[model samples]
Target: MVSRAHPHGDDDIRLLGDDSFEQSDEKDNLISFDDTSGLRHRGPSSSHKKPLSAARSVSPSSAQDSPKGPVVAVFVVVFDAKQGNRIEWSHTVDGSVDIGGVEYKALPSGAHTVSSDSLTFKIGSYYGVAYFRTETDKSSARGAVFRSCGLLGRRLEDIVGFRTVLQSELSQGKHSTGDYHVLEDLVGGRSDFVDNAFTPVMERVNKSEIELMHDNKIVRDFCTLLGADIFRLWKCVLLRKRILILGTPPFADLCHIAHLCSLIGNYDISSPLRPDYNLLLYVDLNDIDKLRQSKTFVACTSELIYQLKNDCYDVLIMKNQLHIQDPALQRTCLTSAMEKENFSELMHDYNLRSSIMHVDSGRFDATEFVGGYFTALNEKILSAFHAADCTAEQTIADSALEDLSLNPASDVPFLQALANMHCPSIRVQRQPLCPQCHLC
Candidate 1:
C-alpha cells in the first residue's frame, strides 16, 4: 500500500532532509480515535459518556494471563537529511528499556522523502509495530515533511491496535510531555485511555501458548504468493541462511513474511544454524553495512539499492520469486517423487479445510498448519538423529516417519546435511533411502 500523502511509484526516490523541519503551531484539543470504528471521539475530558460495554477495564487477570499485553514503549522517530533516522520523543511502560536503540527499526531503510508505510520488526527481545507518516510541511522552506515512529510491545496485534489511536493523537498535534500519559498508561496495562473497541482479542494459537498470534490472511497470502517455493524458502530459513525480502510500500505483508520465516526452528534447540528473526522492515544503503556483517538473518527492504548487492545474502525473495546465490541451496527446491506425494497430501488437507470448514469454526488456521508442519519436521529430524545414532547402517522405522508430513526420502538427506553443518563433530551419514541424486 502506498502512503496516503506520499505515494512512491519510482524505483529510486529521495527522502526528506533536515531543512524540512519547521515548528508548527500545536493544537491544544486532543482527539481520541475509536479503535473499533474509524470514527473520532472527543478527548478523555469530554462530558459525553460512552456506553457501559464500550469502556471495559483491562482487568489484572487479563494482563496476567498473557504477558504480551500492554505495549512496552511509544516513539516518535523523524528522519533527518543530515543524521538519518532519529527519535524525537519516547515514553516507556516503566521508563526502563532504552528506546534510543530502536532508531534503526523505527523507520524503513531508504524510505522516500514523503511516503508513509507501516512495519513490524524485532528489536532485541521486544517486537515493534510502527506507522511511518510523512505530510507536506507547507511552512517549511523545502516543503518536505518528517515523521516515522513506532509502538513497541510483546504482542503484534496489541501494538497495532494502539498504533491507530496513537497516530490519531499525533495527527491532531497533541504531542506534549503531558499528552503521552495515555500512551504510558496503555503500555502499563491500563486500557482506560481507549474504549473496549480498541482491545484486540488475545486468542492463543492451538497447541502452544508461547507461539505468537498471526493473521490467517498474512500466512495464507505468504503461502499462496510463494506456492511450491514456500518449501524451499522454509528450508532456507531452517538452515538459517541469510535471506533478504524486497518489496514495495506498506510493507506489512513483507514484515509478516519475515516474521514467519524467523520461526523456522524449534525454540528448545540451541544450534548455530537456527534462524534468528533479524527483521529489518526497511533498508537502504545505510543499512547495507550492518546487513553484510550480520549472520543468518531475514530482513526486508523496499529500497532498490539491494538489487546490486548479490554478495550479501544467500537467498533473495522478491516479487513472489525466490533466488539463491548458491546452486546447492537452489537445488533443494527439487522434490523427490515421495516428497511430492507428501506435499500433495498436505495441500489437499489444507484445501479441504479451507473449503469445507467455516472460518468462524476456528479449526482452520494457515499459520497453525504451517507452524505445526515445521514443529513436526523439527521433532522428526531431531528424533530420527537420536534413533539412528548418526550411523550409516541403521534405517529409521517407517512408524517414526509416519508422524511427519514430509516423506523420509525428502527430510532424511536434508536432515543429514543440516546435521553435518551444525554438528561438525558428528558425521551424519546420509539415509540410504534419500538418494541424493533425486534432489540434485
Candidate 2:
C-alpha cells in the first residue's frame, strides 16, 4: 500500500480561469498604472469633498480590523555617484503597500509577482510559490528550484537584455569597440593587473547615482530620448593620468611630456573647473620662496586645490608663476599660465633637473651646482678666510714667506714669472735647498 501525502491535494484544488473571475474582485488588489487621469482625484484634496455622514459611518477600530487585502508597492532608490549599489527596483510578495514598515517576505505556499520600474524588464510579471511542509523545508526546496528557473527565466533575461542594449549604445560613440580587432587589441595584449584596474573604475562611473538621477530626470522630461552621462568621460581622463604616472615610463620623462602636451593648444580634457586644461601641479610651502625668486620660475598654482584634497591620491598643477605666500592662489594662476609655450621650458629646468644633469654637454656639469657642492666649499673656505681677514698684513706676509722658504721648489714658477716681470730676486744657490727651485 502506498500512502500519498501531496500537500496540494486534487480534491481541495481550485482554479479560477482568467476570464471567469468577477471584474471587481480580479481588479481589487491590482494597481492600475493605466488610470493616470483619475489618480489625481485619489489625492488628499479629494478627501475633503466626501460627505460627513460617510466619514462618521466607518469607525477607525472597525476599519483596522477589516481585512485590508494584499497591496503591491513599488520603491525606487536612486543612488549618488559614489554609492556602489546597482539595484534600480525591487518588490515583495502579498502585494502590500506597507512600504516603509514591513520587510518583504517571499511566499512559500502561494504564488506572487515581482516587478521593477527599470526599463530592462519586459515581462512585468513573476510567479513564486511555497512548497514542502515546514518553513525551512519550503525555503530550501524553493531556493534550489528558484536558482535555476527564476534566474534564467526572469532575472537573467532582463539583465542580459539591458546589458546588450547598453553595449550596443556604447559601441556607437567615438571610442566604441564594436569591431573585433579593436576589442582584441584592447584585451589580448594587456597585462592582467592593467585590465583589472580599469574594470572597477569604469563600473563605478557607469553606475554612479549622479548618472542615474540625470538619466531618470531626462527620461521623465523628454519621454523616450536617451543621453549619455558626461561624468563617465571624466573617468577616462583620470585613467590616462594614472597610466602616465604609474606606467613603466620615468617620472621626469612623463612630467616633461605632460608639460609639452599643455604647450601646443591641446590640453583639453573636459573638466568643469578648467575645461581646456590637461595638468595641475601643487607646490609645497618650503619650496615656494626659492621658486618665486628665480627669473626662470613662476608659481601658477590653481585655486581649485581644495577639490583635489578629498578624492584624488596625487595632484599635478602646471603654471607660469607661483607665489610663495599663497599656495592655493598660485595653483589657480598656474592653470592660466599653462597655455604658454615658455611654461614647459620652466618646468623642465626646475622639475627635471636630475634627468638633465646626466646628459653630456662638454661644459661644466650641472651636478656641481647642486647644494652639496656649495655646502662643502663653504665649510672649507669660511674658517681660513676669517683667520686671514683678522690677521695683520705684515704677519700674514711673514707667515707666507716662511712657508715659501721651507718649500722653495714650489716657489720656482712664481719666482721665474715674477723675474719675467722684472721683480727683485734676493738670492740664488748652485745646489738649491729646495729640490726644484734655486730661489727660496
TM-score per candidate, chains pooled: 0.65, 0.14
Largest lDDT belongs to which candidate? Answer: 1
lDDT of 1: 0.55
The 10-residue segment with the lowest total lDDT in model 2: 38-47
Where is model 1 poorest over a 10-residue stretch in terms of lDDT? 37-46
**For model 2, what is the alpha-carbon lDDT of residue 218?**
24
Query: Each candidate's lDDT (Cα)?
Result: 0.55, 0.22
Clash pairs, model 1 backbone: 15-113, 16-113, 109-282
lDDT of 1 at 47: 18
lDDT of 1 by residue, 1-440 (tens): 00111111223323433332222122210111112211111111111111111213456666675453457777777655545556666767554555545665666643453366667766655767777766677764446546665777764544554555666656765543336555555655565644343353322112232222234555655555555666677677777778898765446556656666765454344345544446554454555777788877788766555768987788888666788888777654445555455555556666666555555454454554555556556655655555565666455554444354444444555555665665544443333453556541
- For each predicted model, how many residue pairs clash, with residues at least 3 apart or on different chains? 3, 27
For this target, which candidate reaches the highest TM-score against the unseen true structure? Answer: 1
